[model samples]
Structures are given as C-alpha cells and as structure tokens.
Target: MVAAALSAETTRAALFLAATVGNVLGALVNYALGRFAIRFEDRRWFPVSPLARQKAETLFARYGQPVLLFSWLPIVGDPLTLAAGLLRTPLTVFLAYVTIGKAGRYAALLWLMPS
Candidate 1:
C-alpha cells in the first residue's frame, strides 16, 4: 500500500509521512488492545497466550528499548507492541522506538522498490 502510494505522482515525503503515521496508529491500536488484554488475561477465551507474553517480557528484559526495533516483524510485531503496553513502557519511549522502527521499515521498502 505504502509503496503504491509512493509510486504515485504524489509528494514522496508526504507519502512517507502518511505511511509512517498509519503504521504508528496501527501499533498504538495494538498497544491499546494489549492494555485491555491485561484486564482479561485470566479469562477462559483470551487469545494471547502466557507464553507469548513471557517471551515478549524476556525479550524486553534482554534488549530493553532496542527490542522495539523489531516491531516491524510480521507475526511477532503486534505482540511486541502489545507487550510494550502490557509492560507499561513509557509513552514517549514507545513512540520513539516504534516510530523509528516503523518509519525505517517503510523507508527500506520504498528504497528497495524499482524506480
């Protein structure tokens, strides 16, 4: 989607900005869901597993803020954002890491596409 937008005659920088903003918004939604999940964590039908949360926690412990750079990964990405909220990662800190990671991912994608 982003690449297609970029390929249009639209402003390249604006396209990039829009794409990054969209990605960040999606992550924030995941983070909010994570926060909400904490309240229902003990429910019988909760989707996210304890093991997944544990892995996210362990990775956060080991990598600290840097672990967020992997937030662009496909399967694991959403959970990482959720873990950030579940772990109460500071908002400013979360935004910084997430924005950079997401923007970088989009930038890389745009860069690799044929001009």
Candidate 2:
C-alpha cells in the first residue's frame, strides 16, 4: 500500500509522513496488546521462553534503548516492539525510535522500487 501510494506521484515527504504515522500507529497497537498480555504472563500458553527472556534482558542491558532502531527487522521486529511495551519504554522514546526505524524502512523500500 505504501509503495503504491509512493508510486502514485505523491510527494516523498508526504508519503513518508503518512507511512510513518500509519506504521507507528500499528506498532502502538501491538504495544498495547503487549501491555495487556501482562495479565497472562504466567500462563502456560504464554509465548516467551526462559532463554529468550534472558537474551532479551541481556541485550537491553548491554545495548540500552538504541537497540530499538532495528525494530524494523522482519521476524524479530514485532517481538522487539512488544518487548518495548513489556519493559514499559517511555512513550516519547518509543515514538522517536520506532518512527526513525519505520521511516527508514519505508524510505528504503521506496528508493529500491523502480521509478
């Protein structure tokens, strides 16, 4: 959808803004879902494992919040966004980092598409 919009003669800045807003809103929804999952964290059906939890903790401790820049990544991206909510990342910080990452991803996709 974003690629189609960008290819329709929309200004790059406008497309970027729109894509960023929509993508960030979607991620925020995911974050809210994650926050809700806190109620079920101890259930047997919960998805995370001990090893994965340890790794995520270590990475956050070692790398700090800058690791959020890679939230645009595919398989790992959604989980990272969820983790941000699970860890209660500040709203301003989450918005800034996630927007940067998502905007960069959309910009790259637009750039690589044949003009």
lDDT values of the candidates? 0.81, 0.73
**How many clashes does the backbone of model 2 have?**
0
Which segments of candidate 1 are over 4 A away from where they belong? 2-9, 41-47
Q: What is the lDDT of residue 42 in candidate 2?
A: 69
Clash pairs for candidate 2? none
Give the per-residue lDDT of model 2 (tens digit) for 1-115: 4556646877766877888899899778756656777576567865555455556556666787777787777655666666777788887898899899998998897777666
TM-score, predicted candidate 2 vs. hidden true structure? 0.72
All candidates: TM-score = 0.81, 0.72
lDDT of 1 at 34: 78
Instruction: Please name the candidate that would achieve the greatest lDDT relative to the true structure.
Output: 1
Model 2 weakest lDDT span, ten residues long? 48-57
lDDT of 1 by residue, 28-109 (tens): 8878767766788777765457787778878888888778888898867777888998888888899899999999988887
